[model samples]
Target: MSFEKTWYSLNEAIEKFGLEKGLILKWIEDGLVRAEEIDGKVERVNVDDLDLKVQEMTGI
Candidate 1:
């Protein structure tokens, strides 16, 4: 069996990728990725969108 994550909380993304919160927020604001607000507090980002953004930024 294999498990893969399709969405990640903002905090999780920051911690897991060592990325800045402001940058992620900016990405959200710029409509670069899709995000959903959970419990009106936590926000989750789409893993596929984030990966694409990272690849674009890193030129990888």
Candidate 2:
């Protein structure tokens, strides 16, 4: 609910989630969040799923 973007890059998610980049990558590896390849190697985060996970984790 605090985020405004519909999509986020790995780096952006790191900043928004206030977590380390490695942690975000770990989430991707752990299937906590899904990443979509936008162009070549670049990826976009599914903000909706990320938001839901945040809410679940924070009990918001």
Candidate 3:
């Protein structure tokens, strides 16, 4: 079967979604999206949660 990415680094999410870093960070803080710290340094975003938010924002 094929595999799909379930998570993305903060920078990757920002680049892929064309969203500002601060906005993404705020989402994480507001619990609109989920994130996890990797190696106690990099924060990875939950792709599914982010996609849902995008859909809500765009009404698509």
Candidate 4:
């Protein structure tokens, strides 16, 4: 993975994590995943951050 890539939309993140979009959004709101609001609507999660959480949860 490249360091330059650091962002993901709600849907993209869902597919990446194999979780539902609603769950991803809930995680964001729960302060589990860092997110930024772009275009005043879209939520983008840091790809690196998402990966970190996956590793933490699964120990893989």
Candidate 5:
């Protein structure tokens, strides 16, 4: 599977990872994962980075 070119919205991440929106939002708040503003206003996260963060946060 391709890990590149797949950016995820905040909502998508919550559903995809089965994680709380608040937790993902906290990651954005804490600058744990870098958020990019696409189309000028939509905030999106990189899947690759998110994966790394999950590993870091979960230590698994």
Candidate 6:
């Protein structure tokens, strides 16, 4: 099992780390990751989940 601790805004994560926001949004749509939402918008990505996705994508 994995545990999450930190968080990052979608744009910040994507822009700074070269993550694809559209794919992330699609993952959110598919219920693979959890998004913190406000005003019907996703405000941030759970960093641990992002880390897992990154590791999976990069085979790290």
Candidate RMSDs in Å, in order, are: 2.3, 3.7, 2.0, 2.5, 3.0, 3.3
TM per prediction: 0.79, 0.64, 0.85, 0.69, 0.67, 0.77
Q: Mark the regions of model 1 whose C-alpha exceeds 4 Å error after superposition.
A: 1-3, 38-42
Candidate 2 clash figure, as a count: 0
TM-score of 2: 0.64
User: Quick one: how many clashes does candidate 5 have?
Assistant: 0
Candidate maximizing TM-score: 3
In candidate 6, how many Å is residue 19 off?
A: 1.5
Q: List runs of model 2 lying over 4 Å from the truth.
A: 1-4, 38-42
- Sort all candidates by TM-score, best to worst: 3, 1, 6, 4, 5, 2
Candidate 3 on 1-60: residue-level lDDT in tens?
A: 549998999999998899898888888889999999768654899888989989999999
Query: What's the lDDT for residue 10 in model 1?
Result: 88
Compose the digit string of candidate 2's lDDT tens values, residues 1-60. Answer: 565668898778777877677766677778987888656453888777777877888999
Deviation of model 3 at 14, angstroms: 0.5
Estimate, for each residue in 1-60, the C-alpha lDDT of model 6 and write its tens digit.
Answer: 556447788887787568678888987888877789999899998777777888888999
Instruction: Give the total clashing residue pairs for model 1.
Output: 0
So what's the TM-score on candidate 3?
Answer: 0.85
> Best candidate per lDDT, number?
3
Give residue 42's lDDT in candidate 3 (0 to 100).
40
Error of 5 at 51 (Å): 0.9
Instruction: List, residue by residue over 1-60, the lDDT tens digit for candidate 4.
Output: 556767988778888789777766776778878899967665788777778877988999
Q: What's the lDDT for residue 2 in model 2?
A: 69
Angstrom error at residue 29, model 5? 1.3
lDDT per residue for candidate 5 within 1-60, as digits (tens), equals: 764566788778777788787777677778877778758553787677678888897998
Weakest 10 consecutive residues of candidate 5 by summed lDDT = 38-47
